[model samples]
Target: HIVAAKYNIRYIISGGNFATEGILPKCWHYNAKDITYFKYIQKTFGNKKIKNFPLFGFLQEMYHKLVKKMKIIYLLNYIPYSKNEAMEILTNELDWRYYGGKHYESKYTGFIQSYYLFNKFAIDYRRATFASQICAGAVTRTQALKELEKPPYDESKAQLEKEYIAKKLGISLDEFEKIIHSPAKWYRHYPNNEKWLSFIYDTYRRLFKKEKLGNF
Candidate 1:
C-alpha cells in the first residue's frame, strides 16, 4: 500500500488464479504462460529489494476465504491454456526452459517444499494438489493416491540438494538436520496483531450481510 501510494498506482492487481482452484478442481492447472506473465509483471513494476512484511504474509492466507466461492469459469479466463500446451508453445516459440516442479526455479524453495516440508512436517503438498486435480477431472483419484504413495524426491538427489543448501547457507549438514527435526511452530508463536485484526474483521462482517461480506 505504501509503495502504491508513493507511485500513485491506484489499482492493486493480483493474478489470483488460485481463487477458483480452491473451490473447484478443474481450475487447478498452471502453465508456462502464467510464469511468463508473472515475470513480465515483475520486470515492469516489482520492487528490486522487497521487504517481507507481516501484514502482506497475513493477508495472503486470509484473503482466500473472501473469494472461495468465485465461479470456476471466471477464473478460467485467467488461464486459457493447459500446462502441456503452454510448455509446448513456450519451448517451441520462446525457447523457455522447464523446471520439474512448482516453485523449483529457486533452489531454496525447491529444497524446502520438496524435501524439508515432507521430511520434517510430513506435509505432502503433492497429495493436496493431486487431489485437487482429481476433483477437477484432470486425473483419477486412484492415480492421485498412487502418486501420493510415492516419494516426492529421489533419495540420492535429495541428499545432494540438502548438502548444496546447507553449504549455501554456511551451516553444517548436522546442524541443518537438527533444525529440520525440530518441532514446527505456528504463526501464533510469533508476536502479532492477528487477534485485534480478526476481531475488527469479524465486527465488520457482523455489521454487514454475510453474502455482502463475502463470507461464503
Candidate 2:
C-alpha cells in the first residue's frame, strides 16, 4: 500500500485467470497464507528456519482491502478470455517458448504442479485444468481425456527435477523418496483460520445472494 500510494496507483492488477483458478481438488488445497499454520508446519517439518517469508492471514487481507484501499483486481474474471490466443501472442511477440505443460516455466512451480502433488496425493490436477478448459470451449472432452491418457510429464525430466530439488534442499534422495511415499496429510490436521475465513465468506455470499462457480 505504501508503494502504491507513492506511485499514485488506484488499483492493483493480478493474473488470477479464471480458467486456471479454483480447479484444484478441495482436499489438496491448503490456505498457505495462514501464517500461524505455516509457522507450525515449518517448525515441525522444515529442517531450517525460513525467515522474511511474507504471509497474510484473513485479518491482514481485510486490512489491505478495506483500510489500505489496495483493491487488487483480476480483470480476466470480467471478460471472456482465450488462453490459447494469449499464449500465441506471448510466443510470437516475446519469443516465449512452451515448457511442455501449464505452469512448467519455473522449476519450483513445475515440481509442485507436476511432481509433488501428483506423487504424494495421487491427484492429477491436470484433469481439473482440462475440465476448466472444456467449460471454456477451448477443448473437447475427448481431446482432454486423450491427453490425460499419457503421463502428465516426461518421466526422465521429472526424475531429474526431483533429484535436483532434493539436492538443492540438502536432502538425500532416500529422504525425498520417503517423503513422497509417506501418507498424505490434509490442511485440517494443522491449526488454521480456515473456519473463520469460510464463515465470513459464506455470510457475505449469502447476504449478497451470490452463486459460487462450482454450484453451476
Candidate 3:
C-alpha cells in the first residue's frame, strides 16, 4: 500500500487462484492483513521494537480501499491458466530456470515449503498444490502421486542444508535443532480477528458477492 500510494497506483493484481492455491487448507496460512496477530508474534519473539511497519489494522483497512480508491484485480480467474504452458513461456522468454519443485522460486521459500512445514506440523505443502493442480486439470492424479512418492530431499542432503542455514542465521546446529523441534502452535492460540473477519466475509458475500473461499 505504501509503495502504491507513493506511485499513485490504484489497483493490484493477485495471482491467487484455484489452479495453484485452491486446495491449500486455510490453516496452513495466516492473513497478511491481520495486524494484531502480526504485532503479537513480533513482540513475543523479536528482540527489537516494531517501528514503521507497512501494515494497516482492521479499521484502517477500509481507508486504504474506500478512501484511497485502491482495488484488487485477480487476473487468473478471467483467463485460461496452464502452469505447464506458463512455465514453458517463462523458460523460453525470460530464460527462467526451474528449481526442484513448485514455489521453488527462492531457496528460502523452497526450504520452508518442502522441509520446515513438514518438520514442524507434518503438513505436506506439495499435497495441497498437487491436489489443486489435479482438480484444475494442470496435471493428472497419477503424476502428482508419483511426484509425492519421491522425498523432497535425501536425508543426508537435507541435514547438510539445515546445517548451512543454521550457520547463515548465526546459530549453532544444536540451537537450530531445538528451534525446529520445538512445539508447534496453532495460529488461533494467539490474538486474532478470524471470527469477526469470517463473519464480515460471510455477510459481504451474502449481500453482494456470491463466491466463497470455502466453495473452492
lDDT of 1 at 159: 78
For model 3, what is the C-alpha lDDT against the true structure?
0.79
- Output the worst ten-in-a-row residue range by lDDT, candidate 2: 207-216
TM-score of each: 0.63, 0.87, 0.86
Which predicted model would earn the best lDDT?
3
lDDT of 2: 0.77
Q: TM-score order of candidates, best first? A: 2, 3, 1
Off by over 4 Å in 1: 1-6, 19-81, 203-216
Q: Please provide, for model 1 over 1-216, each residue's C-alpha lDDT reduced to its tens digit, 9 standing for 90 to 100.
A: 445444654445553343223332222222222333334445564545334422333243243334332111334436642555667998999999998775688988888877898887676668766655655566787887888777887777887898999998778899888889999754344344545555656765677543332221
Task: Give candidate 3's TM-score.
Answer: 0.86
Off by over 4 Å in 3: 154-157, 167-170, 214-216
How many angstroms is residue 39 displaced in model 3 relative to the true structure, after the best TM-score fit? 1.4
Candidate lDDT values, in order: 0.58, 0.77, 0.79
Candidate 3, residue 90: CA error in Å? 1.5
* Each candidate structure's count of clashing pairs: 2, 0, 0
